[model samples]
Target: MIPSAFDYAAPATVAEALSVLADAGDDVKLLAGGQSLIPVMKLRLADPAMVVDLGRIGELSGVRDDGDALLIGAMTTHHQIATDPLIAEHVPLLAKAAATVADPQVRHRGTFGGALVHADPAGDMPAPVLAADAAFILAGPEGERRVAAADFFQGYFTTAVDDGEILTHIRVPKYTGWGAHYEKFTRVAQQWSIVAVAVMVRVEGGTIAEARIGLTNMASTPLRATAVEQALVGAALTREAIASASAHAAEGTDPASDLNGDAAYRRHLAEVLTKRAVIAAAGL
Candidate 1:
């Protein structure tokens, strides 16, 4: 299907982009990497009156250190994040998740912020970002405001990014030296995750010092597995301990029944994947 014709604007700066976005009303769409939006547009799932390309905005791409955290520009490609030394060292969970996003070509062009703002419950980025406690920076007509991951995602295919707002940057607190992993299950290659678990743990003296868990495709939005995290803390870093903690993985989830699997199956997968993810993340 051919999408409806639309006017296009390539803005070199955030302020210029915001101006066009503000003026274009509800029929405007922002292009960032074009991995998700382009496909939908091609399918006629989305037909905007105007497209504002943010690709020329140089400030919205790259990784930088911001004291205790890392600042990742919204337009930074998944390929860059997957291989960036800063991300690898401080937030390996994100690197791992980014590397698994729809294979090489898509990874090369998909932007992290674009994925988050798309807010697909099955997306690889959201779970890990939630687990890392990342914050999103939004640029809008009223100026900038930061939104926490917990509040950023409103529902399936929805986010805190309003019509006139653009996500400009992401702040990920350093999880340096932590062992982390993203475990995902799909029906076929490059398929959306039926269920996935993102885990990051700090182990000290053979005990879990801290643990963070995020579940993908477990609800209307990415969910923090707080029960699993709480269970893992102070427990020994062993398969037995992880399995025990993982039993609580589905305690607060609302997985959907679909062709790939039923809700019960996803609940079971969450538990099993949580154990595998925790063990791998703990380097056991």
Candidate 2:
């Protein structure tokens, strides 16, 4: 299956990319790592009139310090995020999640922003990014706009990135010293998660000072385990406490039934995985 013929532009700057997208009207797709779009294009699932490739934009491929947060360029690959020193020290949860995405080749080619924009509920990055409370930066002809992760993912395979806009960077606040873990279940490695949990916990003197939890494949979009997070805060770093909080993992999610498993099964997995993820994150 070959993609339908389309005009292509490899832009050297975000401004140039945006210009290409704008001039191409509403039928253009932006290519980052080409991990997601390329496959769909091959299947003709998405037949755009043009593809504005952002790979040539040098500025959109690195990490930068920004006081309380880090600015991760949209074109940064999953492998880079998983191994970068800044990400490992300041946002270990992101690195943990990135490392679990597919295999070596996919990780080397999949872009963080591309994964987030793809917004697949089964994808590994969104839940962790949401749990981290990250922000997305969108570049458009009108200029740039910032959107929180919670608002960024609107539904399965959909996001706040409007027509003619390109996700430029991710703003991740420092979660330094927090324990982080990504627990995923699949029939095998490198498959889309059947159900996954991403957890970050801040412990103080053996007490859970704070916690952030995110769920994958539990809804149309990656979901924050808010109920579980609230329940864990100020609790003792004990298995019993984690088990109690984990029970709330499926309280507010509407999981879809698919070939992988039924919705009820996913809900069950959510509770089980959340506990395991939280325990691992707490290092207990």
Candidate 3:
């Protein structure tokens, strides 16, 4: 099936794109790489009256280091992020997750911000972004606003982005000297995660000093396994401790029962995958 008839406009600048979105209101959708939106449109799941393409908006497509954080433009492709030296240096967990997103063709066409804003619970980046505690810069007619990654995603396929607002950039904190890992459990090479875990740990003198564990597809939104984090604090890096912490992966999550797996199965996956992610992140 083809998308419904719509007006298309490729804006050369972000301002122009915002203007189009502001004028079109909710009837419009901002098109980034269109890897996610185009397929949804083709299926008639989304039929916006107008598409404000941001592909030509140069300002929304680059990777830069800004002191303590990496400023990634909203339109930066997964392919770019996966291979970017800056991202690899500062946020290897993100690069690892980006490389696992779908296949090469999809990665080439998918944008980081598009995947986040699309807010698919099964997508790889959301958990890592949340684990990294990234912030989003949103631009609209009223100017700009900053939103924390924790607050950016409201639900499955829902976000804090208001009507007419476009996500301009994502600010990821530099993770220097941090040991991070992204562990995903999927049926196939490029399949969406049945349950994925993103772990970032700061080890001090062979003890877990700070740890953040994020769960993907474990709830309506990407969730931080605070229980696991609490369990790991000051704990010796041991299999027993990691397993104890990971056992709480499904403690507070409300996972869906779908074709992928049942709630019980997801809980088990969460526990197993979280342990693996924690072990890898801790270099144990």
Screening candidate 2 with a backbone cut-off below 3 angstroms (N, C-alpha, C), the clashing residue pairs are none
Compared with the true structure, all predictions reach lDDT values of 0.94, 0.93, 0.91
What is candidate 3's lDDT per residue for 1-284, written digit by digit as tens?
99999999998987888888777867888888898899999999999999988889889998999999999999999999899999988888899889989999999999999999999999999999999999999998899999999999999799999998999999999998888889999888888898999999988987899998889999999999999999888988888988988888889999999988999999999999989988998888
The residue ranges of model 2 lying beyond 4 angstroms of the native Cα positions read none
What ranking emerges by lDDT with the best candidate at the front?
1, 2, 3
Better of 1 and 3 by lDDT: 1
Q: Please give the lDDT score at residue 113 for candidate 3.
A: 94
Report the lDDT tens digits of candidate 1 across residue range 1-284. Answer: 77789999999999999999888899989999899999899999999999999999999999999989999999999999999999999999999999999989999988999999999999999999999999999999999999999999999899998889999999999999999999999989999999999999999999999999999999999999999999999999789988998999999899999889999999999999999999999998
lDDT of 3 at 41: 98
Clashing pairs in 3: none
Give one digit per residue, the lDDT tens place, for model 2 in 168-261. 9999999999999999999976899999999999999988999999999899999999999999998988999999989999999999999999
Model 3 spans > 4 angstroms off = none
Evaluate model 3: give its lDDT: 0.91
Q: Which ten-residue region of model 2 has the weakest summed lDDT? A: 13-22
